[model samples]
Target chain A: MSLIDIQRISRLYQMGTETIHALRDVTLQIQRGEYLAIMGPSGSGKSTLMNILGCLDTPSGGKFVLNNSDVSVMDDNALSEIRNREIGFVFQSFNLLARSTALQNVELPMIYAGVPKSERHKRAMDALSAVGLADRVHHRPNELSGGQRQRVAVARALVNRPSILLADEPTGNLDSKTGVEILALFEELATKGNTIIVVTHEEEVAQHSRRIVRLRDGLVAADEILHKNGAAAPETPVFPPIHASAHAGPPPVPPGAH
Target chain B: MNLSELIENCGMALRAVATHKLRSMLTLLGVVIGVFSIIVVMTAIRVLQDSIETSLSQFGKDVLVIQRNPAISFGGPEVWEKIKRRKRLTPDLGELIREKASLVKSVGMQNGLFSGEVTSPYGKTEPSFSLLSLTPDGFPAKTLSIVSGRALNSSDEENGRLVCVIGSKTAEALFPNSSPLGETIKMDGISYLVIGVLESKGAMLDNSQDSVVIIPLSTGMNRYGRSPWGLTILVQARSQETYNDAMEEVRGILRTARKVPPGEADDFEIFTNDSLIEQFRSITFAVRVGAALISSIALITAGIGIMNIMLVSVTERTREIGIRRAIGAKKRNIMTQFITEAIFLCQVGGIVGIALGIAGGNAAAYFFNVPPVVPVDWAIIGFLVCAAVGVIFGTYPAYKAAQLDPVEALRYE
Candidate 1:
């Protein structure tokens, strides 16, 4: 069975006397280890769909089966539990706590999950290292560059080992070079058998994913298979050179610089 | 929540508070003042009460006083007039109690009239000291120790001798130097021999206790005539165990001696050191209730301030709440975080207030020449009340933050 199965889901919003349909009768299925991108313009209902898929919001109508559990009718508390265990969200704004270190931000989800301290710390360090931010673990969000902050948010999303790594406009706030580095990290994560669902407006970001689902006017416009399993991902710029511009000045040399 | 999670929430709350240092301090000021007001008053009252207790205890344990009026009375001129009209307890009442009350250890009659000069060849003192006229047992009954010379003996009273005992201050004023014993002092056209000097007792309620003189009751009556309303009877019980029995016996004798019928109440009043303390406590109890009410009003106002700040914090951190919610934090966790922050502020304020209150109170006590008191129970109540105020005021704002829709909050500016 698919990891997530959505059948004819709809989301409605009421503004004064008007009824606005954010999503209407949308059907989709996502298999495990799939890297899919949902792309649309603003108000095209992609955000609503992302919110529903991430279990942050429930659909107005239809079933949402995540890991074979029907989460569509779940209450807020149950949805929170499911979200914690099954989904990891990376927002467009790199929503890391401004006062906390990168490692602490990464450890936040596991803290809510009641992970043991030593294990949580170890996992958090591992996740930050995975995002190539091991040396920046002690730096707060304000002390980090935009790209580094995004990496901290990605590490936080990946720390819990959730079933799907969902990102909403993941590169929306980053420059092209930094955005490419984040895309490369996502590609690497996808290659390791992690399912990733990215919602963005940029076709360039969607091109790196294995599958592209396009949304328009609260409905799916097209679903295209861009690459098969074990296939080469669309060219995302390599890391070190891209990171040069991630920090505005000359690259901050590591403590043990040769 | 687990200990680590609670710690984590507390850490977050601390960070938030640290970021807005000025705002948090302002918010905490209200609580500090509220707590300070209460703790200071309570500490002062405790210290004063302790000092009063020690001073009153100088009248000796298990010693009762027979006077024309109660030791303490409340109300206006009407009540005072009635008390004033009661017949005096004369020296005969003391004799009757000594004769009839087997549990009585000793009985002495004294007059509270001390408006007279104490003169000597060396120096003369103004009429500012209290003079007591009593038999030999008066010193022991009033816990008045003899620092030097000898107290008046029964021979002095029986023979109507002009021997007198001087208080520490009076001796200092009358002799300045040299032993007062065997010295002659002329007063009211008569010469009296100094026999004893009382120990230096400290001030009571800011009144000088050391300035006093004592003479035999027989001599006082012979020289000055029987004081119509100034006679005071002192009775010492055999022991604390027989105190009530002694008092009952004295009452019965006085009633019979004064010709009060069986059905009628005694016109005079009977009291002890304990009764005086009890009356003082009752009066101060009203003051304590008033202080508590005023302090609670201030605390409630402070609580309202905390609630307002918390609400503002919730609004300012809407996006943060969204991020936390999306990352798997339950509403309860969010609520816990905000409430913990509010409670942290109040508790910090409470601790500082308590310290200040104790310090301020002790300062007042020092000025009043009383020992300081900790008032442990009031401190505990202050802590609990601060925590309670936090919870009472914090819940609504915390709930508001927790119940925010993650989707809407994420979009909030």
Candidate 2:
């Protein structure tokens, strides 16, 4: 059975006196360990789809089965529970609390999940180390480089060991070199048997995933297999030496793979 | 949520506020002013009430005075007209109460007269003092203790003797360092022997107790002559336990002596410590009502200010609320965080205002020569009122925060 099952889902919004159709009769399924990229231009409803998939929003009409549970009719509290225990979200802005250090920011999801302080601290440190940001745990968002902030956001998303990692334009604000580094991290997470869904408009960013689903005007325009090796496309050059230093080292290797 | 988790959430709320120092301080200003207004006014009223209580206590316990009119008048022209039409309480009524009342321990009548120049062998002072005439029992009835020499005896009043007890001021003015006993002082061109000098009793209602002379009641009636009324009778009850019984008996005796018909209201007025306190309380009731009404307006305005600022805070932290919600925080958690912030602001304000109010009240009391008293009840009420203001004014903002859509909130700038 697929990890995520969406059958005939639609989302509608009311703006002043007009009706806005954010999603229209979308049906899709995602299996475990799949690395998929959702591509669309601005106003193509890709972000709204991402919001629905992450359980932050509900469809106006549809059936959504996450981990074999029918979540379409679930109430807000149930959705929040699923979001905490099943789905982790990474935003484009690297939404780290400005006042908190990297470690504290990474520990936020565990706090909401009601994890004890000692365990939360330990798990958060481990997640940060997985993203190669362990040495910069004490640094606040303003004190870190762009790539480091994105790594912290990724660490926070994974701290709870969520079933799926959902990245919404995760590299939209980063430079090309930093974007490539983030893609490498996602590729490694997917190999560890965690389902990954990334949303973006840039083709180069989408090339890192094994599959690409393009959205247009609230519907899926195309779905195609992109790569099997989980490597960047040939057109994109290797990141320069100066930008490479910002990342701790070479890209992480996928877990359980030589 | 469990208690530990709730406490942890509260800690996060506090940290959020601490991170924004200037914003939190500005939000707290409304609560401070609201609490300050209530506490300051309450403290002032408490001090005034305390001073009045202390003044009344000085009159001693279980003492009653019978006069032609009440000591204080409440109504305007109508009450004064009724008082003017009533008959005066005579010395005969006092004598009847003294002779017949079972609950009465002692009774005396005093006739005040002879206000003029008093000349001693040492010097002559013009219009510097007044003379008072009293029956022998009046000394003990008024709680007057003689510091030196001898008080008047029954013989002095019965024989219309020309002996007198001098006040402390009068003794100082007439005899100076020399003893006032056996000295002669001239009042109204007549000489009298100074039989005693009274101990100093500080001013009562701003009237000097030392600047008077006491003479025999009969001598005052004959030599000074009566002035429309004979004397005002003072009665002392045996003890606090018998005070009510004493008052009832005195009322019955006075009514009979004055020849009032059955069912007719007595013409004489009876005053006691309880009655005087009642009169003061009525007057202060009006003052307190007026003060509370005025202060409440300020407090309400401050409450509105808190509401407005809390709404602004919710708007500014929209993204934070979204982030917390996405991470599994419930709507209740969001509500609690904002409400806690609002209440914390008000509590801090309450503490600051209480400190200032106590200091201000004690400073005023110091000027009046009374010991400083902190109105603890008012302080407690002030804190509760502040917390109430937080709950009342913070509700809408907290509700707005709780109603936020996680998706939209995350998109807010």
Candidate 3:
């Protein structure tokens, strides 16, 4: 079975007296280990679809299955549990707890998942190391650079080992070079058999992913899988691996490859 | 939640509280004052109660006293008028009770004079010691025991001897080097030979109970006009079993001796050690209630202040809440976090208030020369009350934060 199954999902919002159809009869399926991006203009209902997929909201009408559990009929508490255990979310802004150290921020999801302290510490350390932040674990978000902060947020998102790594405009705040570096990190994570989903309006950010699901007017506009050997995976990453800690003062320029 | 999770939540809440120190302190000001007012008053009352207990314990449960006035003035001038118009008790009434009441163990009369200085050949004391004259049985009635020399005998009363008994402390002050027995002590230039020294008791309130001088009752009556000031009749029951009967018999004897008509209020006030505690309670009841009322009003105002600050916090942290929700925190998790923060604020204020209140209250105890009191019960109650106030006031804003739509909250500027 697919890791996620959504059939004819619909979401509606009531504003004043008008009913806004954020998502109307949308169907999608995502298999494990798929690296995909959802793209749309504002009001194109991509945000609604991402909300439904992330289990932050229940669809008004749908048959939704995640990890073989029926998510469409779950209550708020159950949905929260599903979100904690099955989804990892990265946002446009780093969204780190301002007061916590990098390790503490990364451990936040497992805290909600009721992970034991010692184990949570070990796992948080491992997650930070995976994001090349082993030396920066004790630093707070404000103390870290923009790239390092986003890296802490990503480590936090992936720390729980969730079924999907979902990011919304994950690099919208970064410079183009730093954005490309984050995309490379995503590509690396996806190559390691993690199911990664990126939602963005930027074509360049979407091009880094293997598959693209385009949304327009609360419906799927197009779904296409680009050939990785041909264009998706370049000879050299369009942006090379950049660890903020290794180059704090100035990031070394990467050779452009398209 | 489990202990570990609760601990984590509490730590996070504390951090949030620490992040905005001035805001949290300002918000908790009312709570601090509320807890302080009640705790200080309660601590002082607690000290008063202990002082009274220590002092009154000199009189056993079987001992009773008949006097012209209550142990304390409880009410307005009307109560004073009622007491003032009553018949005065005299040494003769004690004699009547001794003669007629079968349950009466012993009756003694005391005529207390103004406090005065005493001087011996060796030294002189401060003008702070009490002087009283007692009949022979007054010793047993008051549970006073002789530590040295001998107690005054009936001859001392009948012959109106110029012999006197001094308290251990008074003896110490009067003759520091030599024995007070067979020594001449002068009160207001009237010299009397010390015949006995009473045992020492614990310090009651400010002055030690041991700083007292006693002479014969007949001598006191002869020297000071007996009827104008009145006398206190002390009665001791034969045993614990006859204590109530002894009190009743004495009431009947006094009524007959004074010719009080049936069904009329007795013209004298009867009290015991236990009754002193009761009077103390009545004396403090109004102050306690007033303090509680003012503190409660202050706490309610503080609670509203907490609600206002928390609401502002929720609005300010909307995006943070959305991020937490998206990061897998449930609605209740968010709710718990915010409530913990509010409670953390209140507890901080309460702890400070309790410390200040204890210090303030103990300052009064110091003036009274009473032992310092902790008032642990009041401290615990104050802590719990602050927590309750936190919960009562914190729920609404927390609920509002929890109910916020994650999509919108994340998008909130």
Name the lDDT value of residue B387 in candidate 3: 98
* Order of quality (TM-score): 3, 1, 2
Instruction: Superpose all Cα atoms of candidate 3 onto the true structure and report the RMSD in Å to 1 decimal.
Output: 7.6
Give per-residue CA lDDT, model 1, range A1-258, as digits (tens). 778888778899988999887886677888888889999777778999999999989999988999999999899999999888889999889989888999889999999999999999999999999999989999999999999999999889988899999999999999999999999999899888899999999999999898788776677767777855566543431111221223233333332231
Using DockQ as the yardstick, the better of models 1 and 3 is: 1
Provide a comma-separated list of chain B TM-scores, one per candidate: 0.81, 0.73, 0.94
Native-to-model Cα distance after best TM-score fit, residue A15 in candidate 1, in Å: 2.8
The per-candidate count of clashes, in order, stands at 0, 0, 0
DockQ of predictions, in order shown: 0.61, 0.38, 0.52
Where does candidate 1 stray beyond 4 Å? A228-258, B59-61, B67-90, B108-232, B238-242, B252-269
Best by TM-score: 3
lDDT of 1 by residue, B1-413 (tens): 87778989889888988999999999988889889889998998888788777766767787998888876667799988877777777777777788888999898777765567878999988876666688888778878888899888999999888888888888898999898898998765678889888888865443345777788888888877865367778888999999998888888888878788899777888888888788878988887888888889989999999999999999999999999999999999999988898999898889889999999989978987876789899899999999999999999999999999999988888
Tell me the tens digit of each residue's lDDT in model 2 across A127-234.
999999879999999999999999998898888988889998899899989989998889888767677899998898888887787766666667676655534332
- In the range B1-413, model 2's lDDT, one tens digit per residue, is 65545665566667766877787677666666666666776677677666766654534477787788776666799878887888876666777888898888888888778677788899665595888888878887777789999888899998999999988888888887799899899988889999999987765432346778889888888886555363678898999999988888888887777787999887878878778778867876776676567556756776787788789889989998888788777787788778877777677777887888778767767777666788899889888888887788888899999999999999999
* Clash pairs, model 1 backbone: none
> Highest DockQ: which candidate?
1
Candidate structures ordered by DockQ, highest first: 1, 3, 2
